[model samples]
Target chain A: MKRLWGPASLLAILLVVALMGSLALGEVRLAPSEVLSVLMGRGSDLARTVVLDFRLPRALVGIAVGASLAASGVLMQSFFRNPLASPGLLGVSTGGALGAVAALALGWTANSIFALPLASISGAFLATFAVMALAKREASAEHLLLAGVALNALFGAATSFLLNLTAGRFEVSGQIIFWMLGGLENRTWSHVWMALPGTVLGCMMLLPLGRSMNLLSLGEQGAQSLGVNVRRLQWEIIILSTVLTALATAVGGVIGFVGLVVPHILRLAIGPDHRRLLPLSMIGGAAFVLVCDLITRFLPGELRLGVVTALIGGPFFLWMLRRPS
Target chain B: MIRTERINLGTRLRDVSLHLLKGSLTAVVGPNGAGKSTLLQVLAGLLKAEGAIAWMGDDLNSISFPERGRRLAWVGQDLHADFAFSVRDVVAQGRHAFGDDDEFIDSAMKALDIENLADRSVTRLSGGERRRVFLARALATNAPIHLWDEPTANLDVRHGLDVLQLATKLRNEGRAVLISLHDLRAALCFDQVLVLDRGHLAAAGNPDDVLTPELIHRVFGVKARMGQEMILELP
Candidate 1:
């Protein structure tokens, strides 16, 4: 059937508009033609730096982060096969948060821009392995989610305890606050250089598996009979998704809603075909995060990034969750 | 063709010998909870059974997934249609293992009389229609070896008979079709028969000699009476 957006294509359009919105509707606005001129590299050096150097990286990073989070969300939802499944709820973002918080506390991230992502990737991988081990032997959706909850609570409490201990002693109060809230602020070409490669590579790995995942949606036994090696497939996706969530968090700091909410909305629009669903979410996720980031920059008063995302996402997520089964 | 030797892997299948020739109709019949389904899955290599399941002297597991798709097809009990895919999509998925086989898919759908329901969503189909679609998918594989688990379940008398008749036709066309049946009356039409009870082979061979009233009573806890036309029925 010909669809309105087919979820995937609709998200692609939204991503372009959002990218334009980020470039044109910033604190200092620019015209669409000016943005296009800058995009095409024909604009003056001042416009070029202002557009390409300042806004382009921000917009591109938002898309990268958004796509990463959305892709992570799809993996979690498919692995658990639950609409409510999100990287945040499953403690994956929490792992990234803990990793960032740890690097800040240990004074390891001060020397290089790379330390944050490196530490965060390590933390996320550790959390993933711990949960996998805890739920191994007889793992199902419920058991995996439960393990995620336990890890989330434990890591959350530990992160808070560390913050409380360093509230005065470390003199890193601002860093702690930023670590918790999540942002795309002051993100430069260096951060992009570090994160974009892994994010793109991860997507490449995941895209091929989309058709295989379509088979998996029929349940593990169904995939197995169709010749899918279930355990290997599960582990591969988990590892790939973990890396994406970690790198995004490492680069952009725990951006919420994009990963958790985008896929559910897309699924409702397009019947689940991962070949279509995965790429669609990539574009949709980028648009959603970029819009939220732009809105946060001029929200009347000083607004925390996580608070802005939460204010918008919390209500929408609850509504989606409460929709009749 | 499909071939298996005295391929017993130790103690699991001492009495689990099966010799299904090409173009023969075979039915494994028993009451509920019998190992009939298990045997079908094992022979189809969906399970890791002790006995060997060889297709033309190639170890079953050694064959690639797509290769097996061209040679053996299995329809398990309690099928899961978790996605909201159109019926055509579900049928088309069967040909996924056999690339570029739209001809096979069209013929398979025709065989099961599901051509009319091609565009209908699988989740919306009635039980009988769903069975036919699944059967069509199996046939779409164009496999030499076909295994079906209670293909007649939930089907009305007519659909049940249609399922048996179609299976018979496939066998006549030189496909090794193994069906697990709860209906003994249908088994009377199959060339070879095996009855299972509590994971053991209760009886095997031609329906006349192996499907006696005493054996039926012992395995099913019910009396079987040979009526006017050698009908196997409960008293």
Candidate 2:
């Protein structure tokens, strides 16, 4: 219990500070107290609009998306027993992108905001399930990764095809490309509402799976002998992780690496007990993305969120691989 | 008791019948590709076969996964600790069906003389130490039946003997223990032995009766002696 307190408190403090920093250090540059006053419902209209209407939802959505992706990453790594496994690398997020793009291309969003998210969720599910089925049929970790690679290409190509089809409609094509690049700029409370339920549900579902996931890390036969229904558990993890990743993608385009890097770092610091790893990665991921978003907002140009994550994550991953384990 | 009738698993294993009894340790011996591991898997209910396998009198298939887990503990030939977890953590996994109890994990580690290594990362342990950790996991399960596939492989003499002695202890405790082995001498000490050849049950019965020199030559295709201690000459 005491062991949890130190890291847990540290992450909580980091998250609060990042949240405050994101709220206070944007274009208007308000103080922490000013942001707090607005959050407590007593600030001027401009302060309320900037802090509550704008930055607060953006930061909250970033936290939710970060937490979701990180949680998904933990699940993927444990499910595959490979530290490198993640929704982004596996084409799951790409599948979600294709879904959102398809919804936009078909003008479904004009009907309702819900249509795009529902489509993205289904798309994520299909991609994840396809990869899982391939993994099962192949029965090799390396092969599963290969399947992910192929699926990623297929999804990317499909997304490209959709973009090409929408080229005549500048508005639709712009939306598609921007979503594919992935960002959280100009996001609103509605986006927070869109992602929060799935993230919460996914975390709740993934939390209990920690023990089963821990057992699974021992290898399939070992886990089965301990009474785990490996196939069923895999399906559960696939559904939850896909849904979470899809929701995040729907709200924030295709933010990468929060899932990949946050869990890997936390595993190194805290060890591989998913019981602790799952929840801690959530807090760490929220802090990580909030900080990353802060960095992106301060940059000279309009850099995409996924680009920043890949820049930071790719090198961190390389350094990790170079480090002696 | 575990009894299988005409169990077949595609071409890898065919027409295999077995009777594994409690209060005894049964040794399964065979050459490579002879289905020794497959037989243990079928009995452990980890693999489905096109035949009836019963635990006591109930159909093994009808028994739920968790129920079977409580009844049987299995240790596979290949041991992997890909993730960094302590030796005690690996052993504690055995208690999944029964829930967390530090005492069982502690005793299991102690029995394998790994109490000192309990806090050490399993991935960092030596091959023999990792084998012991796996064996300790099976022991910690406290299941009525144990199926171990080549449990002594990669173990040194002392640790190898520890595994054999542990099998004997479990048998004495009235649990059924089935061990697949490449070690003929170790198999010779078990109460009963089942010899397999090309997925066929070549021989079965008392080890003393089944492990004849001629049978060893015919089934294993090796010149062997079964005297006070079984000795083999590889081809």
Candidate 3:
């Protein structure tokens, strides 16, 4: 759709410039022309490797990871109807991490690239399922949020216990740590391959239901008058959010705060119609994750992407939480 | 276009039998818990109506969801929220069923006099402003049937008159508007009134003949008298 032409477009244009900077400002510092050549398939070996093999994959991961989290964030926020709701708030990220750890623990995924995301997806699905089962009988936004908090705690406990049990295994432990902290250190095209399908699928499922979501904001009884099949839509949304979250978590482990911050900022800018809101969130999310990845990869050190996001988002989150309603 | 016979909507609606015609401003008036809202929901294809709501003489449930949404527009209660949206965005929700028709949205915004507020956030609007925005959204749906759950609740007296006058205009345009109102004066101004008392239909007819002193006393448990010009004076 050729519709978005306001704050969202400016952000998108800025992202394009930032993406160019991201490809150029790394260790080797390739010129824009060199980066273009590498993208267009005719560059020096180091430029090609730096831009295509290393920086390109990293940048792509940033966009995908950011977008997936942001869209998932928007969906979950709308799903729970709480401004504070996010993938992290609901503990879906932790659950997916545990699933990735489980896949590692099984020792069957050492050679398989799909194992991590698949496990994360399953874990995310299970965690959300547990939340749903606990509060299904009296399901309100508050109850659902409480259920997410409780399940998040339980999943955290389980993941910690698994970490404690597998303390000596470096490969498994390292994978778990990197996954837990979140990173795009050596992400390949295959990682991009895995994340793209589900994110696209999730977008396909959720955007068409945007009007139904608007009806939902009017509250439950209000929705029924608009012919909204509330239960069915709720289920689809929960599952779609889980799937998208899992895909991101599986590819890059549990990145936090993109879901929390991006949609909210965009909502403040564009308001709450999912049609406009969701698209803006996608652009903003991609920008946020790309910026974070730029910081993590080019800023020199073992500071994990997850840790960087937490450090940035933590104060912002608390500031948001405490800044008076 | 709503026909219900022996459709049990639990406690609110008990073995109700009613047929509501289209293209007139029909007021559903009652006290609290009179099942007026429930009946409106049933007619709008919102509730899990067991019996049929024949839309143009076809089974309502048998049709698809999008079709139903395009056919019926509902203005619900308690629509206020903490989340801020522009008056334009909120009103654009009505045209959602119309499949992104910009022409429809442009005129709908103009009709509701919310064109100036298009860029302004809805959270900052006054009570009457908010109510008018919601009404504008419902109108933008361009559906033939409109169900409003106290559409004039928060409006000032002047705005309330505007709402009623707008309803009259919509009705005259051959659109069906069934609104539930606690205000008897507003109900009297409507083309027709359906009196509900304790989840049962007390009476149904023109505002004058149907809203008799006896029916008023029976429904509201209040002594009432009528004078010339069909003015109702109540105690």
Candidate 4:
């Protein structure tokens, strides 16, 4: 228990620093003091518009997306009893990406701003349920993973078909490509409202399950002997992880690697006690995404947030795979 | 403290019924494919068998998972740790159904002589050390009925003897203990012995009466001469 405090404190400090950096280092580049004054409601209208109206919502959305993805990752890793398991392993992100792409290709976004996210969320749920339906009777981790793999392939192919159909329409194709690459650019309070509440509530629901998840590391039969209803826990893990991944992808597009990388690092830093790992991963994930988003602002080109994270996380993931556990 | 009536699990376990009393040490002995492990799993409620299993007059199936956990503790064969959880954390898992009981966890570790390895990751432990860690976890449960499958499979001779002694001690404390073992010589020390052959209960009674040379030859296909403390096999 004492070992958890150091990492917890470190993650909290990093989150605060990242939040400050995110708010202060945008195109307007306000000083820390100016940012604080604006937060305190004593700055120029332009500063308020930048910090309060624009940057604040974007930062909050970044935190929500990051935390949700990480928490979902923790749940997935625990459920599968494999460190390689991530939220996207269940095809939720691919489904969301397919939905967003289909929405754009079908000219649904011109109808309403809400069309894309709604369609994306619907796609995610459909994919997850399809995997569940295929693997429901046995409900074994291996079965679920195999089903997820099949669904991911199906969704990825559909997404590619949609992209191909829009190739002649450069504007629609470009929009599809940008959304697939993921970003927090031009995010508003509506985005924050869409992602934050579900993220917070879902994480809170996951907190009490930490102990049960820890027992689950012993394998399904072992956990069952320890009083965990393995079937119920499996369902809960699936529902929570899918909801979190769906919400994150709905708001931020197909952000990858945050879910996979953050939990793995936190599990190594602290022991695999889910009670501590779950909350700490949430903080670490938020900090990581905020830091990554901040990098997107300072980059030379129009680099997407997802591209920067992949650039960082992909190499780290490879290094992890190469190293002996 | 356990009673089963005609428990059948596919072809793995045939209709088998037995009664276990508290404060008694019972050993389930069998040859390869005799369903010893399967019977233990059925009693542990890890596998759902046909027919009925009751503990102290309560139906095992009707009990909630948590409630059943509080009453029965099990250590299965082929237990493996894939994650880097500390030995202490793994042992503490035994107390999961009952809440954290540090004293019990510590004592369980001490009983298994693994207190020094408490902070070490179970994934890094040797096979024998991992076996002891899992045993300690089951011990930490403090359940009324204990079931162990091949509890001494990977243990050193001293640790194996220690485990048998611990089982005896648990029985002495008025808890029921059931173990599936291949060591017939060790089974001699148990108060009662159950002989299984091809998912059938061939015999159940006092160890001295059930472990006769004719029965041993019939079930194990080994011509053995039973002595006071050991069984010598003939080529």
Candidate 5:
């Protein structure tokens, strides 16, 4: 228990700071005390509305989405035994994008709030099943990775085709492109509610599987010799990771790098013990996205959340690749 | 005791009928690609095999994989270090079904003289050290039966001897230990030997009886003799 304190506490502190940053530092800057007063129901209407109605939901959504993506990233990397693996790489996020874009183009999102997420969830499951089918045909990790790449390209092409179909309608095309860019801007309590259940469920499902994931790092035959049902575990992990990634994509669009970068950073900071790494990556991921969102909020020209993450994460990834392991 | 009859697995292994008894160490010897690894994998239940396998009069198929895991531990020919995990963590995985037992890990590490490497990342370990780490992991299971495929493939003479000695220790403790080896001299130390040729069980008996020069020459395409020490020479 004591051994967990150093990294866990550090991550906890960072998350709190990022959350506060998300709440206070925005278009209308409020002091920490002003945000606190708003929370206590004592602030003026403008402060209350700005902090409670706008910033709060966006920050909450950012945290939830970030944590979900990061947690799923940990599972993906462990499952594939590839550090480069993340939920986005497997076409799960692309599937969600396609689903949500399809929903928008069909004008189903206007009729009901649940339609987009439901469609996104189905899309995610479809992508995961497609990847699983490829994996079943060939049990090697490299083959599965190649299959994921193919699925990603296929999903990307399908999504672009949907966007092309909506080109005649300026409003729908703009909405699809905005969502694809990915952001916390204009996110509301509905978005938070939409992402909350899947995030919580994905975490619950993934946490207990940490031990099995650790064992899996030894490779399939080694894991089996230790009594792990490799096939079953892979299926469960795929489903849960898809849920997490799909839900986040449904609400926040295709936020990149949160999953890949957060877990990778945490693994380096604290050793790769999934028992600790999984939960810590959740916290670190929430903070990372929140901080990145906060940065985007201050940057001129209303930068997309995905652009901000790629701008920072792309270089870091390259540097990591160049470094001797 | 483990008994198999006409257990054919894949195109590589066919008609492999053998028995492994408790309180004995069995050495599996074969030329390259002669289905040695496949035989061990079949016995470990990692491969689907046709025909009958019984363990202590109970059908091997009836036992659950986890239950089979509790009874048998296997060390493969390669332990890939694609990720960075501590030596202790690697050994701890062997205790998955049995739960965490620090004493078991400690004793296994001690057996392989890798106690000081408990916290060191496995990726940094030398080939010989990594081989010992894998051996320690298999030993840490404390299973009643052990199947090891070339556990000493990259080890020095001293460490290779250490592996055989550990097998000897496990046999003395009334555990069934099956190991594959390229070293005929090391295989000669085991209580029983099973030799393979082109996926067929060419010989099985006491090492002295089954590992004759003529049999070695026929199976391995090499001239061999067991005098003061076993020797293999090009034909």
Candidate 6:
């Protein structure tokens, strides 16, 4: 427990810096002093509107989304006992993407702001249930992963079909493509509210299961012999991780590697004890997305948030694979 | 003290009944498909069989998982430690059922002579060392009943002897120690021997009586002679 303090402190510091950077560095480019003044309720109306109404909600959403995805990743990796497992391993992201794209293609986004996220979450839940149903007989981690893979392919194909149908309508096709690429642009307090409560509640529930998850690393029968309720733990992990992934994808629109990369890096830095790894992954994940989102702001010509993360995380993951453990 | 009556598991194990006593070291010996592992797993409460497994006259299923865990410490065959958890971390997991016990973890590691490797990752350890780490993990449980499936499989000769000595020590402490063995010679040191042939209890009693040359040949399908100190197989 004592060993966790240093890395936890470092990640906390990085999260704060990233949050500040996200608030200060944007299209309007407020100075640190001005950002602080606006935060302190002493700035001009324009600065106040930009900082308080716009940047704060966007930054908060990034933190919540990042933390949610990373924590979800930790759960998936530990539950499956496979480091390669991520939030998308269960098809939640693709399912959510399909729902959001279908909504946009069918003109549901114009109905209400909540329509996109609600549809996305419903789609994610359906995909997860489908995977569960397909793998219900076996219910092993390997079987669930295989089921997830099959569902992911099906969902991806369906998303493409929607894209094809909307090809003649440039506006609809463009919106679909933009949502798929993923960005935190024009995010509001509603997005923050949509993500924060569930992420906080889900992570809180997952934190105490760390020791049981450690026992789970010993294999199914090994863990069972150690008094872990393997079946119950499996259900808890599936529900919690799926909810987190759906919430993040609903708001962030398929932000990819924060889930995979954050947990992987934190596991390397701090040992594989989920007690430390889960919380650190939360902080690390939020910081990673915030930093990545900041980079999107600096880059020329409309680089998407998901594109930047994949660009960075893909190469880093390849390098990690090349390096021997 | 543990007792089983007419235990059966899908074709793997059938009608195997056995009794174990405190302060005794018992060895379960059988061929590859002889259900030795299935018996151990059933006894450990990791598998449910058709018949009754009672601990001190209480039905095994009646005991809660945590209570059962505190009573039985199981070391499975070919258990994999794929993650880079430190040896100490893995050993500490033995105390998980009873909550944290650094003293038990330390003593368990020391008993297995793995104190120096406590900080090393279990994933990086050799087969023998990894086996010791898992054995230490079971030892850390401080449970009265220890169920080990092929505990000495990957160990060197000295380590194998050490494990036998540790089992004897545990038995001396008035705990029941049951191990499944592929090494017939090691079975000689046990107080009682159970010879399982095709999920049946072919023979059970004092090792000297149960492991007779004729019984060995009948159960194991091997012609053997009991030499001065070892059993020799004949073609």
DockQ of each: 0.29, 0.70, 0.32, 0.69, 0.66, 0.67
* Least accurate 10 contiguous residues by lDDT in model 3 chain B: B226-235
Question: Which segments of model 4 are wrong by more than 4 Å?
Answer: B226-235
**lDDT scores of the candidates, listed in order:** 0.76, 0.85, 0.77, 0.90, 0.85, 0.89
Q: Summarize candidate 4's per-residue lDDT along B48-150 as a digit string, tens digits.
A: 8899999878999789999877898888886667678999989989988887666589899999999999899998999899989989988999998999989
Model 4 / residue B166 / CA error / Å? 0.9
Question: Where is the poorest 10-residue window by lDDT in model 2 chain A?
Answer: A136-145
Candidate 3 residue-wise lDDT, B1-235, digit = tens: 6666776676777666766677688999987889988888777776675665677577886867667767778877765655676777777777555565654666777766678888887778887788778778778777787888898788776667767777778788888788999888668777788888777777887898888788888888888765555443322
lDDT of 5 by residue, A16-92 (tens): 99988888997798999999999998998888999989999999999889999999999888888877788887788
User: What's the TM-score of every candidate structure?
Assistant: 0.86, 0.94, 0.85, 0.95, 0.95, 0.96
The best candidate by DockQ is 2
Q: Whose lDDT is higher: candidate 1's or candidate 4's?
A: 4
Question: Which candidate's lDDT is highest?
Answer: 4
TM-score of chain A of 3: 0.92
Candidate 6 deviant stretches above 4 angstroms: B228-235
Please say which candidate is ahead in TM-score: 2 or 3: 2
Among all windows of 10 consecutive residues in model 3 chain A, the one with the lowest summed lDDT is A218-227
Report RMSD for candidate 3. 4.1
Q: Pick the candidate with the highest TM-score.
A: 6
In candidate 1, list every pair of residues with a backbone clash: A8-A280
Output the worst ten-in-a-row residue range by lDDT, candidate 1 chain A.
A1-10
Q: Candidate 6: which docking quality band?
A: medium
Pairs clashing within candidate 6: none
Clashing pairs in 4: none
Is 3 or 5 the stronger prediction by TM-score?
5
lDDT per residue as tens, model 2, A1-325: 3356789899999999999999998789998888889989888889888988889888989999899999999988887787877877667898888899999998999998788777887888788788878878425667777888999999999989988889889998988888777788888878888888768878997898888889897787888888888878877887788888988988888888788899888877888888889999999999998998888887889778878888899898888789776
